[model samples]
Target chain A: MSSTPVFITGLGAVSAAGTGCAATLESFRNGNGNPCTAAREETPIAKPVFTVGDPAAIANAEEMRTLRLATLAVDEALSDARFRKRPSDIRVGVCLGTTVACQLNDIDFYRELRASGQASAVVFDRYLRGNLSAAVAERYGFCGPTLTITNACSSGTDAIGMALAWLRAGLCEAAIAGGADELSRIPMAGFNALGIMSATACAPFDRDRQGLNLGEGAGILLLETDAGVARRDAPAVLTCEGYGTFGDAHHLTAPREDGSGLEAAIRGALTTAGCAPDDIGFINAHGTATATNDAIEGTVLARVFGTDCVLSATKGYTGHTLGAAGGLEAVFTALGLREGWIPASAGYKNRDTSIPVAPVTRMTNVTGRYALSTSLAFGGNNSALVLGRQP
Target chain B: MKTVLGVHGIGMISVCGRGIESHADAYNHTQSADSSSPIRVCRVADEILKDRVTLKKMRRADRFSKMSALAARDAIDLAGLRVSDGGIRLGIVVATAFGPHRATFEFLDEILDFGDAGVSPTLFSHSVHNAAAAYIAIMLGSRGPACTVTDFQYPFHAGLMTAAVWLHEQRCSHVLVGYTEESSTPMDRILAQRHRGQPSHEPVLFNFSPYASKMFSEGSVFLVVTRPDQGGVALDLDRFKTGNDRISGLGSLWAAFKDGGLHLPQH
Candidate 1:
């Protein structure tokens, strides 16, 4: 990997907090989050979810909700980076992290197959293009290497990490890295069966927290190389310092009781970024509010950052967006660094005594150049990204 | 910071049979095309692993996890690296388009058969997309970084690039990067519907899969990658990126998208 810094020049976000980066920032600042009151169409469970706003007028539904959400996010990021007017060839790369959209579990089609063992190709084709990195790349006319990572919830963070590797490896001049997933019945059913979906809006890090509320959205960042930025005259927002990931290899759905994988991943990120634990201004934790996840992550955070560490868990604001969680949190972390305020951990009133970790209940100002974001996912995949303020 | 990795070992599994020989033979067939069936990747039957001693722990494991572990063992043996030593740093990266769908579907069945409250946790445990990658690391006793990527568009390329980055960053001295796909009834049915109303042609691997005949086969290809100075055929990702690339494991992936059929890059 090149020692040269990788810059996050532009960013876009669309989540339950609302569209655009400013909306989420304002919601975080005001503690106003909207979790859907009713279940989605044909959903198997009654659990609430956080869904993104309507599509931009220009983005048609034919593009699919999942793909359109991504396009909308990317467009905002590009415009934020001031690349809309200046159109120069800068070899772009697209790496998206997703779950339902990328997989083949169309319930209606599967229901028909289960009934009569038959279905139509049209539905399959639609499902095929619904969630893919190539589709997003093709949509934007990008020819750089495209990859879709499905490491479950940790995917978005890994995508950002992978995009940084691509930049350091000189794979492309600029890259689009983030994650997206639409709310679907299949996952809702799966999580319900597993007994993790909260019936109401989730209260992350709360002592009496029930479980995670499912949500849908997309978070994107436009990364540019020095040469690309110089050519396009784009402003660098923040530096993508380092990314580190490791798997527990201990269980499939459950994280290790010790959280050794996440600890190692954090250490790896710190080592890669050459930043000390004290240097991280605040942490954007993957506090899903599930019993095991919260305990494992909270324990790890307490041990690493000590009791004084200011932590934030945004799941309360936007629910657990699964694959998109990492990207959204990373964008929030970037916005926090740029604006000099860390969003409070939404829905958190009291901390769990057993886990022994607290979160920022109000948007708090901090003074530091580096921030850490962590994702503990289903595959026992633990990924951490170190985002640093640009000098 | 660019480093070369020697392709110390290679392991493959498909429906044709086990070992590299079976996979190689399956693709080299010169017979004519006249079949009315969707191409399925070769699967590992119980009889195949009945004799293998390394898979004793896989008795209760899902086939997806088993395939990745079995293929990785073969590659480790071929690479001449003793994983039991635990001294060699290893990173594992596995990529698949349809991840552990057999188990995922089974979990779905459990949910329907037994209501949400009565579902089995074990079933859901094996159904996650990263299960196989986790199993691979555990089976190898590799304490290094491990990751799983799912993307139908060139998973091997993504996996390879990841492996290369791990090598360059010195995160892991050796990376076990591979691809694993399992054939499932629902997926097969979906593919069948996608290609329905037309006669199925003979199976062709690495050939042009023009929307109509895209080869969605199952199987795994694992390579033990190390520094070039260690010897054997060197794997250079940048070389493949620029041109004149003959990357092992990632056969003509370019053919799938290009209307102009894929031509093997010059050696």
Candidate 2:
């Protein structure tokens, strides 16, 4: 049996709010939003993306343009973990989830290479494949196992889950786990082609909900084994009680009509955490605001936790970060638990009749020990995580 | 004390060949790339793998994942378990430095060209990292834990560690491990962009069998590892008692023992 309790020693996030965990947490508490009109595209929806920084802003930016959004998020998370520069003796493992990394860069680099026949294309090698984790490892001076998970939207949650396992198995004293994605024109075009991109703002679980806006960001959390935590001075924000992952294989993109796969994932998480429905105070829902995701997730929540659980989707704040959704949502859930305040679900007004669950439309307060964060992704990948106050 | 692990069955495929004989032949040939070329690649020609597997869906899977699944399947069959009846508590795990780069880039092309309209759902679905594991599970009808791991460098070894933990926890009876690295159009583009003046390298996949500790090779490595039984085949891991095998390069000890082969590659 696992005897020791793992703790959150540090956090790093690169979201619309800013680059630091403290900034993100502050935005969450103050309800600061990072929405802006899209700068490059003429399409109304494409405008107002949560861009990190202008490509022209950074030094030698084009050389590393292929770098994934997960890289940014991971850098912050490692910084958040508070590893001193060139520190030795810290066994750090990294696990990240994302649907794609530097996919946008790949597209540009390939296009340019094909067009010019000159190698003057975008820097695709910098963020190719596992280099995202390698970059983080090199940045933080960690020399342990590195794992990257890509399970649609649930990838981020799975990353965190694996981090917990890394700690539980005593593989590493500390781990930096999260998910990230830099917006790719390919996914945006695909979603748009699928006719899911909302023309305006995404209104998850709302009757007037149109569709979702593809956004880019990264969310990362630092996890430490019990021994590592005991050596640290800061208190843990929240304890990760359990995480469960499942795949439907039912359909590629669409979820099960009955939400059976999602149901199984939620039950698995709850069972693993030994928590009951009544114990949960808030739900950081996947809530893509698409007709399919919202309806299915809404039905599953209503059936499992009833309509009373405070539900919210942060996509309004950070357009669906895809692979990073779960990690970002997990971070949001942890922040909510630590701050003792439930955040308001942006772009939600009237709850859709199809979804009987009552989504928290405004900021509310609740004092509960447990909370649940759920994610449903393309290819029917589903996952749920349970977080609670430490005893 | 933690239980020691062993490897029982092993399979691998690459530009070299499939199975153990192919491994020995390829290495003896000194199949290194020519340093004088602008781009050097050790690629498994499309016709070769297609001829061997005789599976049509092989086209849909990225080369890396195809090699991965092939290596895993070879290992599973070598283990001699009846998957139809579900005898072994089998799980499928694979590590790849890049997850389906070619297909990903293809999806990008389709989405960009067609404006994301009428993009093949099949292409979009196959672009995911776990698609290989999902395909392997469906092909093998495996109900046990199925996961896809990526970490850019030596992802297969990292996956090996993960499988080890699963065994330690008694989560599964036997775990099948495979790793493959394939070239992508974008990967080439990225390489050219990164080291514009430096010599280029081609995509390569390295496979490993449990009996082999042959490092520095690129291909898929498949090994069936089992819990130690009194009569079961075992590879003694006395040198790696502490679990901190990072420096000792003891990641494949469990694979070696579980492979059940008499010979092990000596460094």
Candidate 3:
């Protein structure tokens, strides 16, 4: 646990559901946010994915779509935090979580190089500019420690958790912690090979759901130290109370069927927050809509928070955004804390009978001080965060 | 006062060999870069696993994970600590630049050749960044917190900082932090093309000053970091500098720590 409060001062996201706070909120208000788009020539999986981003801008930047989405998300977050206008002397750091975009292997470039003995350096040069967080820090003129975490799906949530540690260790006074990933053929085919990519819009927690629909986006949150928040007079979006991350040495792709890893993570978060399980108002589950993932996650929730917990899994609305899911859902969790309500789990029509609890099927109002957001990624990594409303 | 932490033991598997004697000899002899593709990790891990009865399960594991598991096992043995506890107290941090590139390429090749339907699940599963860390945990029976971070510029620094924080918070009794780099055709070519100007005959310090130091190597480095007061070489962390060719002087750091911090390298 942190000695002082760490607040989420600003939030930004660009996802398949929508872009920017207003656009995303409006999409949710209107209901049914997962809008499908045609697959691109590069990512020719044939399955309609919830691909979202500015294609022209992404092509123009050529710095990589992940970097561009990060820039957009960071710009919006800075503007929201009012850091764009007010310059402070506090040390700032950047921690990002990413997957497909962060890797250096460019299949097309490598193929061309292999075939013709020559390939353009556009992709290679971008890869050399450093990792995702370093690019972000250079763009924003940040001087503190910058790290890029590549822990698959839990990267974003774990990134935020690590940033909190930085604050506690006096390594940085403020931080931009989040995740971003661009849709690419590599992961699409990989997940499809894994048999987890759904042909239709994902139906998280629904008994008859096929699998996840791949999505792309960025989610960023600006965090501040207590003194820095007071000195800068920054408004708190919500308070990050606790964070816990653990791994299961089980299987490479499959989570522990007993849900031990996830259960430990949730218990760690709750313990650090100094809160009981009943104190949590709602939960935003990883909820990838895969039979294995949803079933394991539900059992873990029941084991930790009892059967009557009010929870929702938002992947149905945004699709499974891969690495960005954690950050995107963190923003959603923060919004739930701020607005005191959580939207229904979109497309969840039926529930599995084996699970003790079902997802929140309707937009539900809640009155509580805290909410929990959980993420379970590939490689058996499980992470949970406890967030509290501003007092 | 805060409990200080230092690197207690070091384990590595480079093109040179397994332990410190081989690495030091290679460093002194200007060991020629392996011209072979995908620079392979030595059989130190296989030898270590020879005595253990659980080798059957790891037969299908990728080389990247094998290198990490071997390096971590050696480091823990050197440190003489028990990390294979049933409790959720240990922390494992693995840092890498490429992160299982061989497996990744193989997986991608399957996708390109056979489409998604024909790709193997095993290949796809091992392609993830954290698979190596997971393997390390499994081998050690460590049910602790684990994470994998990737970066080309400063991977070891990031891992060290995270380990320092974990020790500071007393979240774990000790942390096994490791850094691994694998040689791939593209990476080797990029390094060769970029660093052609540097003197390649001698093992000069990889300096990042001015602009491009232009060198990349394949190997793994593991450090058993514990509380500073518990006794080890006090690592001299320089003020964060921009990228350079100066290689990480882990060898010097290990020597200084093991010999009481007298021979800190100038580089």
> Which prediction has the highest TM-score against the true structure?
3
lDDT (CA) per prediction: 0.74, 0.65, 0.75
Models ranked on DockQ? 3, 1, 2
TM for every model, in the order presented, reads 0.89, 0.81, 0.93
- Candidate 2: TM-score of chain A is 0.90
Where is model 1 more than 4 Å wrong at Cα?
A55-61, A85-88, B1-4, B27-46, B49-53, B56-60, B83-87, B107-120, B196-217, B236-267
Rank the candidate models, highest lDDT first.
3, 1, 2
lDDT digits (tens) for residues A1-391 of candidate 2: 3534667666556666555567666666665445666723333235345555534322345334224455666566556656565547678888877765623335555566556654443253345423556666766678867777766678789888778777887878888888877666566655665678787777778899888877767888888876776665545656887776665645556777998878877887787677888888888898988888899899999899987768867787777878888888888887778777766777888857768785777778867888899988764667888887764
Model 3 C-alpha lDDT versus the unseen true structure: 0.75
For model 1 chain B, the run of ten residues with the poorest summed lDDT: B241-250
Q: What is the C-alpha lDDT profile of model 3 across B1-267, one tens digit per residue? A: 142456667777765667654666655654554455332112222354342443345678876777777778778888777765454267899986668877877776776678756888788778888888888877877767787887776677677777877777666767898877665565555555555466434432222111344334556768887768666666534532213334446666656756776344554
| Model 2 agreement with the true structure over B81-154: per-residue lDDT tens digits | 66667556676677666666667777767755665455765676667677777666656766455667766445
With a 3 Å backbone cut-off (N, CA, C), the pairs that clash in candidate 1 are B14-B42, B15-B42, B15-B43
lDDT (tens digit, per residue) of candidate 1 on B158-229: 787778777776677788888777766666666666665655434433221214364444567688887666
Across A19-41, the per-residue lDDT of candidate 1 in tens digits comes to 88988888887885678866555
Model 1 CA lDDT for position B11? 72
